[model samples]
Target: MISQAAYGAEPNKDRRIPVTVLTGFLGAGKTTLLNAVLSETSSGKIAVIVNEFGEAGLDHDLIESVEDEIILMQSGCLCCSIRGDLAGTIADLIERRDDGFLRFERIIIETTGLADPAPILQTLLIDPELARTTRMDGLVTVVDAANGSKTLDAQFEAVSQVAMADLILLSKTDLISAKVTDALSMRLNGLNPTARIERPVAGQFDPKQLWGLSGLRKGVRQEDAIAWTTSAPEPKIDPLANLSGLSKPKPVSFAPTPHDTRISSASIVLDTPIKDSAFDYWLDTLIALKGPDILRVKGIVFLEGIDVPFVFHGVQHIFDPPVPLKNWIGDDRRSRIVVIARDLTRPELQRSLDMLRAHQPKTGTKEEVLLGHD
Candidate 1:
């Protein structure tokens, strides 16, 4: 039977959509990389799907679809077997164009920073469902100049991020110490002898640095994601496969739940509610300091002052203000946030959350605070 993902007919029979997979550490600037592409190229229409690391969809909010068909996949890492499920999303994007919902020809799937390019690339070579129509154009991996060492030392995904990259973009080079940048370059060379490395602040280098990477080598040598290691976990780091890796182990994922922890990305709901001031501070600080380290951030918070819940979404350094939601989506009024970052630890994230909650008021309930009667 013809698959629904096949869109009832071949999108371009005898031709395929060249798909570029972008991977980097959680906030290494992949989204900015995509937006930059919009300005530099006039390729056959371009469609982008931004996969965030949260359960609730948020990546879509930040995407400025040049056309509605320019879609975003605010779901989990597209490197897993589950990424195969996104065949439907691909189908939808194509159908929309076929129906004139959009006007683009090429497609880009930008994975969360924490993603391993292995599984994602494998899907292109292996998934029978998607392989027929989509051609793997290349893999682009973004690395942060400031903390690339720590990420490479502590996270396995970091090494895989470099190894699988056809184009290695070293972002935020101006922020790191010169010595650190040199060390990072050496390490990158040690890990992946391949890949063309491009620096972020090299006086507006050609954005074309991200182009022309063919998927895995013709043979099966590229399929062994495990052999590509010796960089992550830095011996003690033990980065998980690209399929599902986490920096810390506070939460465990079960396959049966709707939580869908099968991928490297996951979401957490705070038991303690966050104050508006607190959440705002979190946004400002996270974006200011670690923004480049983050791939995407989206959440519905019960702000301390607003009567309605505030919705916020950000992709790396760029952020959009919060929009008010009609009412709490569900009665479990606790604050919920979905973070898709590469190599970020649970302890560190909780610390970030705790830091955001440090000085919040405990005098009244959320309703009392919102009414201005508190």
Candidate 2:
């Protein structure tokens, strides 16, 4: 645990404060980073939020021997599946500040390895409500220099984790030889050229390095973070199942022995444009049917004659209104859909869409058959 005497960053007089993000693959030494920051910073009075133990338990584990250390974190506040919704947790810190619980200069959040950095950043960047109160300093990634190479090669989450860092710490390099360390450093640089790399001796150096966050940031976009090597459900599920999975044994929407769910995701590319009204009707029916199960969806659509691709992001039932993009990221102009959730069958979702789309009426194209208009 970094002591209060070690911290130096004072709260901003007007409105700016640094909030450091401590992220890395599990057991990569994020706790070590927190310990370093807490123990060495010249700043006085700092607050830390972590995921491992009750927030302060992580603090205590970091510097367990320090007798004067006063650490505090409630268990209820620290949930297991907490990824990036720390915006709510951080908001609580402001309340505590008003009540005088602690006069910390900076805020630190460490996430579990299974988490995605994009959503966390989105909670910071996209949430205009939270942005008003907090400003992002930078992302600090603690890398396991010893076994990082294998993790990167094997895990999609690891690649995403490394891709989103602004400052990277390569810990435990001394345990390995110089040659292996140099190779890993090069690989890290290739993944994120912008991040400054520091090989710390167990985070036992000057705390000034992690202090300033002006240099740590990236273009606010998920294009760099989006990755999918994993496969979704089989290609047998119906398109209408996009709304509701085939749960009923009696066959409500074509039950095929229960492999997929009611709310499924499928990618579609049209040679021609879809009528705006028709698209709305389809979306409406889908949501009405099974919006509850639609976990996350990302797609780039080439709408009829619209030159630019339409980018869409949706979480569960909530969706960001579609945004027009200047162009697609790759050669395949066809739409790409990444659906993440349980009980979803991709094949049924696609077929239902195909049939419904074929049934569109020709009065400037609207849903009369599906909506029972004519």
Candidate 1 residue lDDT tens string, 92-168: 66666679645565667777666655555555545554666676666778888787767766677776677546567
Where is model 2 more than 4 Å wrong at Cα?
1-14, 54-85, 215-374
Candidate 2 global TM-score: 0.49
Model 2 lDDT-worst window of ten: 365-374
At residue 336, give the lDDT of candidate 2: 39
Best by TM-score: 2
32-139 per-residue lDDT for model 2 (tens digits): 666656665365445666664543235444343321222443311221213345766677666666696545666666777777665665576566655666656666
**Model 1, position 299: C-alpha lDDT score:** 51
